[model samples]
Target chain A: MAARERDGLKAVPYRSAYRRVAWFVVGALLVLGPVVFTPYWLGLLTQVMVFAVLAMSLDILLGYTGLPSLGHAGLFGVAAYAVAVLSTAHHASFWVCVIGGIVAGTLVSAVFGLFVSHVRDVYFLMITLALGMVVWGLSYRWIPVTGGDNGISGIPRLESHAGLPVSGPTPVYYVTLAVLIVCGVLMARLVRSPFGYTLRGIRENEARMKSLGFNTWLHCYVSYVIAGAFASVAGVLWAYYNGFVGPTYVDLTASSEVFLMVTLGGPGTLVGPALGAGAIVLLKNVMSAYTHRWLLILGAVYIVTILGAPQGLWNLRVSSPPRGTRRTRR
Target chain B: MSWWRVALVVVIAGATLVATAQPVSPPIKLGFLAPLSGAYAQNGRDILNGLLLYLDEIGYRAAGRTIELLVEDDEAIPAVGLTKARKLVERDGVHVMAGALLSSTGYALAPYIDSMRIPMVYPVVSADDLTQRKRSKWIVRTGYSGSQPNHAFGEYAYRVLKLRKVATIALDYAFGWESVGGFERTFVADGGAVTQKIWCPVSVHDFAPYLTQVSRDVDAVYALVLGRAALQFMRQYREFGLKDRVLLIGAGTTTDEHVLPFMGDEALGVITALHYSAALDTPANRTFVAAYRARFRKIPSYYAESMYTGAKWLVAATESIHGHVEDRAALVDALRAVKVADLPRGPVELDAYGNPIENVYVRKVERVNGELQNTVIATFPKVSQFWKYNPSDYLKQPLYSR
Candidate 1:
């Protein structure tokens, strides 16, 4: 098996050096973005980065594992509410709130994962959607804890370990950028690892992988949990950035938006989801300023993208390459 | 001539042109943010049309400055509203902001507007906190707060209707809670007991279950439903045979004029309270109704009236300061100081909290010439947002939703 994998890797040379250089340049520009743009743009870019993290997490399950989830925002929203409630109600520290949010999100997703991992196709989608609706209902109906539709407001900014004010746009942007880069690198490695390969094999042919002594359901459950944990991180960042959390953040519209970002960017690619998030967020904010028919324009763009670039906007260039031509050497 | 000599000559010519150019004062950019494309689009468009109509009536010039309106859609979402509001202030550099259609959006943008030091006039969003506990100096609510009409309705329900016992069937949200709380406070204080409080979900399609749960012993039912939900609840209430059994009263939005035309005879004789009514017999309201109907081809709802009043108030304040909106603090002060004695909705003045102290009309949904109308039955004069309670006392209490 190892020899066959080595031969597969040998079919394509590694492009690590080129990829590293590209990342370094991207990182530099992201760091300098705050200084170059106005505060408004900085705030918007910060939101884009936060949502990019969320989109990438959704990509992990939908792209890699072939697990379509409509409840991704459920995990994200629960974590946000956890952080919001803890920070506002219990006055928890930033690190404690972050940990609490991630743990809460993971726990909820684990339970949901356990229940839905065995299901396939539309059933999985339906179950996940139902779960998402349940979370939305809780947030909307639980007046005492979630503040109902008005939501929990007056959330304080993130306090650093040194107790410095790290809640401003520049600091938040840098923090989000650093987290996004680290998460992107880790996620890339995860998808390339042996375990990640197993998940992909399962995605391609679950029966073949299962017959080869693989626990496909276990793999999917773990992947779902991990994806949910990452989504929670984005949720915490969002809650703090917006200084508020409401049911709308976790509603069906938000979940569908995450799915749209993942699919629109090229589901399987790490950078695709982020790019997709950036495109959609920028479109909504920028186009909305010019015309009231922005939603119509957005729908038109989606239709055009689907028709012109079936693989995705980001995959336009890569479509020309043979399927295995771009494979990297192990 | 050499290239450098020709360049120098052109530079001199450009400098001379610059020096002789008249300094044109930039237009006063007034930003209007509302949900122009989402659930409340109709209400939003009506508000915008009302504002634009006033601008058109005044020839778009206010106090020697051309009033340039910068409109943006908030999509009725808080986050979107905040983003659009920021764009309006930061990118377009609007001198004044106005026209928010949702309470949540208003609540989200209020603190941001205060931080930016931009004076904002709210037309329709009526979260009570914007005027009470969370009041900002830079914000003036030209529209009614959630509690304003409800407070008056409570009085009317107790005094005029002579109801000793009532029940509330309100939408389960901040606005609903505020409306119910205001009614409960006043009704209970006026020697009336609330028999039951039933909260239905905002998106409930069938309100029959909730309607059946409403106590039959109550003298009146105070409802706080809005939009299609209101339509559904009213239809169901009548279908369940409860409408005739009990006195149905509510906030004016329950039988909004915009929806009344389509509500048929189902909404007739329904009593509600609000700050504005198109059926107001005053000369000012008569003129406003005529102009609005002639322009929009529809009777103006309270939202339109509020925004029209808001625009008129801004114009009056701008005229008072001779169009100097550059000084936001002075403009806000002028806005707060100017009292409208004969506006479309009658006399209105800004209270200390910058919320309007106006007459809340107790209106009845009556049919006149086969057209549904909110006919003013009684008026609660000089009602403040705090109702009869002291300002500080009201602030000590948490928000109704909380």
Candidate 2:
């Protein structure tokens, strides 16, 4: 017991040192990635960052609260459409468009959460799928408003209210990077807070949480809306980046892709989803240039990842226990 | 010193020598975006084959420079299309682009092409706005607009066929809406009434309920359906015995040459109008058809013809400019100025909108040597995209939307 306590004490400084090194490396990459990457790769990295935000939002719902949403794209696409319509039609300022997208996404999610909050498991999945399809139908069939299958195009690049030009690929990538960092920090804080603990408790034992006087449904509802709002942030950036929005963005295929990213990354891990997004987007954009069967390669990677490391690539390492854990337990 | 350092030094020296030795002109890279692996893969293949066939005939050289073609599959999604297009421009550094089979993809790409200042030659996306309301100087469409052939068909149905009452059925989308709109405008102006108009969803598998609503009082029915849907509609129309009761007319793609041979007798006697027909008895068309057949082991469709024409136009423009596409504006001007007196589709000229002004042939599906063919019976010469309507006036009207 004394030897185990000594071993535990020895692990503390080493673990903290490891963490500091990891963070330092991450900071260095974040600062220098744009400089190192070519313009084309920068564009791709920007897309990866945008999708990372989206996958992280999905992770918050499915991984934390165990909601298993299939209509995440509906929120994302609605926000994009809102931004597109306001900016194109009303000529709203950039801040106004961004807020409008977030509000629209939040409101839609609130209403949808009200409807589906009572359902659980497969029923919830089906409802979300149906909701996604309805949004897609609206975008596709409402030709006058949504521009039908052609979608809304020619959205001007984002500019500050003061008319400072924040356009072009480089400026846009930096803007997206800033937003991603802010969202990542906020989400990490949210998932570690007391409210986050309650969510995990509910996920593990809903009845037990209910017995403990927790309003599980309200918690789920709030998480759902929060996830939707985060997705909208990604959508707003995407709309500004692509300068276009179409029904394809809201379709079931897009929602399924986010779910794939969440699962392929370690679910419930903040950075895992971002890594997954990077891997998937890179595999698609980079590998596609060299070969036509990139999808096949992606599929092979997915199968290998699933079979070899079921907890995802992020959790593959075997680690020593942290210092003081054995001492505290004893 | 290490062997690797010596190897790196030799490689740098070799690169410097090659850079200084520049003899031949650099190759002009042309990017081709198409749906190579999705629902529209077959159509994409046909278009690519047509473009490549022309290049092959020229021995892959134009304007004293080797022409390099880069193909990317967009999977028929607009977002994917835009991403691939950007990759081609920013990464591959392609000077020009061609081939967008889906209208949605084409529409999404219009602004990007303008922003990048690269010219694009559209082969088979027939969105009218690309050449009309939202026309861009950077774009030149070698393919027909959605409304072009329908306008001619409307006139022919009213004048030659002597149809006073016509009903229309089409897929409920931009292409369908524009087609019927063009037909309605022309038919109404010619003192003919359209009895009924039916729009079915693009993914609709059953056309029974819609077919039942087609009024028997109409003198003829004009339908605009594409791909497998066209085949399904034709077979169902035959099964319902409506073919014997009323004259059936359609947009050119309803009985498109690509689908006709496979359709057997189901498409017999169906009349339509289009810019190109393989059976167009002319020296240029005969030679094109022969070469296409010899190369691809099949008769060329309008898609193949459109891409072939686009390739020919690109070659002509490149030759005129002595392969100097470095000046984008000059290249665009050169492209606009060149007029083809003889193409597989006959004489073609670009209107102010950069859309083709070419002959529209009114053809019928007939069996020739036990194989189905679109046999041209009437020709509307030198038809513009706007048909007889004044361009300015047409642009004043709101775009056709359902």
Residues B182-241 of candidate 2 have per-residue lDDT tens digits of 888888899999889899988879899999999888999999988788889999998888
Clash totals for all models, in order? 0, 0
lDDT of 1 by residue, A1-330 (tens): 111221123332345456556667776778898778887898789888888989999988887788889989999999999998998889888788889988999899989998889887778889999999999999988978987777777677654422665544678778888888788777777777888788778777799999999999899999999999899889888887777788888989999999889878767677778889999999999887777788899999889987886566665644363242222210
Worst 10 residues of 1 chain A by lDDT: A1-10
Which 10 consecutive residues of model 2 chain B have the lowest summed lDDT? B257-266
Once fitted onto the true fold, the runs of candidate 1 whose alpha carbons sit more than 4 angstroms away are A1-28, A157-168, A320-330, B1-23
Error of 2 at A108 (Å): 1.2
Q: Pick the candidate with the highest TM-score.
A: 2
Collision pairs in model 1: none
TM-score of 2: 0.93
- lDDT, model 2, position B236: 91
Native-vs-model 2 lDDT? 0.86
Off by over 4 Å in 2: A1-16, A159-162, A165-167, A318-330, B1-22
TM-score of chain B of 2: 0.94
Worst 10 residues of 2 chain A by lDDT: A321-330
